[model samples]
Target: MPGSGVSINALPKVSLHDHLDGGLRPATIIELAEAIDLDLPADTENDLADWFTAQATSGSLVDYLKTFDLTVAVMQTHDSLARVAREFVEDLALDGVIYGEIRWAPEQHLTAGLSLDQAVDAVQEGIEAGIDRVAQAGLVIKIGQVITAMRHADRSLEVAELAVRHRDLGVVGFDIAGAEQGFPAADHTEAFDFLARNLFPVTVHAGEADGLDSIRGALFDGRALRLGHGVRLAEDIEIGREDQDNTYVTLGPLAQWVRDREIPLELSPSSNLQTGAIAAWGDDMLDHPFDLLYQLGFRVTVNTDNRLMSGTSLSRELALLTDAFGYDLDDLEALQLNAASSAFLPLEEREELADAIVDGFANA
Candidate 1:
């Protein structure tokens, strides 16, 4: 997998659950921090990157989330948000992501006096700029915005309205993020209802920091179409093993629903390990439930939940998985197909993306 030498980078991919704030370049964070005169956890970019990785490795959901405070602190201004979004798209293109849905909480970006509309517009502008840049370079890429509301905050209804208002411009979906443990999706029932009434596609961050109950709330209450890191849904599986080749498996009600419905789980291998989302399974990539889910016919797609923090790209994550699980190009293509099918875009657009992935991997 390692010696493939850019094969992974050239293979087309679909990104379903990458975060805009969490994917900021470390150097950009330094520059943005300097502009705001904010003190960062590390003085140098290298140290800052290391600090982020360490913080996320704490195995406690709260400690893992603390790293976001620094990233969000510098993203308060319109210029900062625009720059981050632009670079985010460019980074995705470089990682061979043909299409991506970038999710971020607009409510968090309003501290600099920018209205919710202005924040969403700024990101749209950046996304357009990045698309133009890629086109100029003779590479094609597409991106859509997933406007998110912080679940712990009280402004989800307003943010949901913002997302619906900008659907035609660039926004493609709505999500509830932040503190998945205490702030259940039920807490944002108003926002969820607003989104549901508007018929906007919704993907909720569930089963990462919480358990099956949180995931249940996300589906039944939030009406989520896709699950963000629903890795912990593995908790519902009871596996009984014999010495050689004989293993019994039983799925709980929640797991049965997710698998029966083919709900896509955005499985970020490195991020899951760093955040301890897979702690109940094991401490390494081999221990992830991704293979289990895949074998069980659950829709599973690989992702880099945070590129900068995890020091990964979509290509790198795929390569890592290939190395861990002995997956060939066929396996990779199936994952891309899963992501393309689960995208919030129209059916025609999703089909186009799926075709591109097929052609790219066929050539690779």
Candidate 2:
């Protein structure tokens, strides 16, 4: 509804790549930190949010990741985890997200004597509470937890097992996050193999801090059903002009496989720019490979990798794309449909979600 006077926030959307720890409310962080007497870089909520956004936009994935230290520090206990999870759902509901998959590393929430199962249970409790709240507010929203393992850590197999054990509770999928450069998905072979054998869904953090090789490992080693910010896959494409008014494009094997298979690319515009994932293209949104990838038939879905860090929502990301690429309502609907198809849900549920998105967008 571009110029039709409809706000993007009112449209139903699906969020596939949001991070749980990365989407904490700054005010909640302040409150939680006070109970634990945890030191913070800023005391005020606004100031702390500003600090996180500043740190995240430093154009280095390593530096951007450091901001998580503060958010994760406050999420060690059961109550804090549940509170964060609840608020995460509430915030997404406000942003018009009909469905969302919140990913977080259960291994990181173990500093407060929480067992792996205990952490998962706490998050599920929070999620259920949030869902009830949303229903009370006369809105419908669905959430699923995508348990993650730190790529640099050696506990991926255990985390994968944790996800499988909790699959019926609330957990939906598995992911290996953190550094994606040297610690490729190959390092977590046992975990990925186990997930595959169990028929569990997976999405790996690749093509963000690394190139096509990392993406390849994600496919071959991790067997990722989706690529978390697979922006760097564009590196495998070569675009050239064939004439003054014509152009030609060639896709490498990796890019071809991803496109042909319709593997979703969880492209986070602000997060990608902040982490320098699209630095080869440029710093601006227009330089994003999103438009190119979309035009080239890649199943590119919009996401907010870390809402707190990037200061964004799924709606805002879609609006940014429209502004940068002159997209209309149909374009936005296509992106949401991509996300709906990419969700880690049963085929019937995904179809229902897709129908809901279409109906919502049509009414908008």
Candidate 3:
């Protein structure tokens, strides 16, 4: 129980890259689907949960993304979106996350006769309701939305404007997500420029389905403040022969810049394995570059990129990393602090979150 002795859940944590649509609870998906008369691969809650995990880990790129279709189907309405968003917050609180930023594409939810503003309003209502529920339970939690635009689509400027418009309504940031290869952040330069002009924070989905070039584009073209699942940045790091003193490591230009800039890499261990993001290294959690990045002094934060698909949480992600890399409580604490520091909140609020995390870990 050395690792389990200090409950990962008891340590205050920050979630910086969680996906809203990917984090839907299976039971909630079931109820919402039933109400909408949508057919499901599994009817029972347990079976539905297993279906999501199985589909994600099936080794087929097509299968991995199919799970999102189910969750997205049930989220096409105002009531369903609000309900899912509320439960999304509640689940993070239960996982001991003191602060979280939920990311999702508003354009993907517009097929149900909901305007962009309406969808944002609905999710904000759910998020606030969830926060109130957590307070009633003698717990404290805060959540911010990171509105995303689909990289394969042409609505980024529109979505970027939507995010900026709702900044005061719990929207704190902007992002671009979708197939990484062939759809670089450069495609959305205008949107990125607009965001930059307005000083809105942005994170780009890079280094997951592609390599360092995509990450470079995310930073240079998108002006991203953080890299979502930027695990592949390890491609720029060279691991050399080991000597008596230590292992020789070399950083390429991009990796050097990222490290020197202290840009946080939102690494999701289980999701990376399931999606074959770390296949270049190996098909195991131990193959993940998370340990290498952290050990090398790069800003690395643990995440559950998609809880339902990966069957993981912030606590579970830490536990998996611990099992694979032999991380101790101190290592886990450092990861949370990195996430707190990289949050899109104002500097003062980020400092407050960091202090709260430090105190929570000290008490734990």
List CA RMSD, all candidates.
Answer: 1.5, 0.8, 1.4
With candidate 1 superimposed using the best TM-score fit, by how many Å does residue 194's alpha carbon deviate from the native? 1.4
Clashes of 3: 0
lDDT of each residue in 178-215, candidate 1, tens digit only: 88889999999998998998999999999999999999
Off by over 4 Å in 2: none
What TM-scores do the predictions have? 0.97, 0.99, 0.97
lDDT of 3 by residue, 1-364 (tens): 1254688888899999899999988888888888889999998888988889988996544468777887888898888889889899999999999999999998989888999899998999899989999999988999999999999999999999999999988999999987778999999999999999999999999999899999999999999889999999999999887877777899999999999999989888898899888889999888888899999999999999899999889999888888888888788888999999999999999999999999998888
Candidate 3 — worst ten consecutive residues by lDDT sum?
A: 58-67
User: What is the clash count of model 2?
Assistant: 0
Q: What's the candidate order when arranged by decreasing lDDT?
A: 2, 3, 1
Top model by lDDT, which number? 2
Give, for candidate 1, the lowest lDDT window spanning 10 residues.
1-10
**For candidate 3, what is the lDDT?**
0.91
Task: Name the 10 consecutive residues with the lowest summed lDDT in model 2.
Answer: 1-10
Clash tally, candidates in order:
0, 0, 0
Regions more than 4 Å wrong, model 3: 1-4, 60-62, 242-246
| lDDT value, residue 122 of candidate 1 | 93
What is the lDDT for 331 in model 3? Answer: 85
Query: What's the lDDT for all of these models?
Result: 0.90, 0.95, 0.91
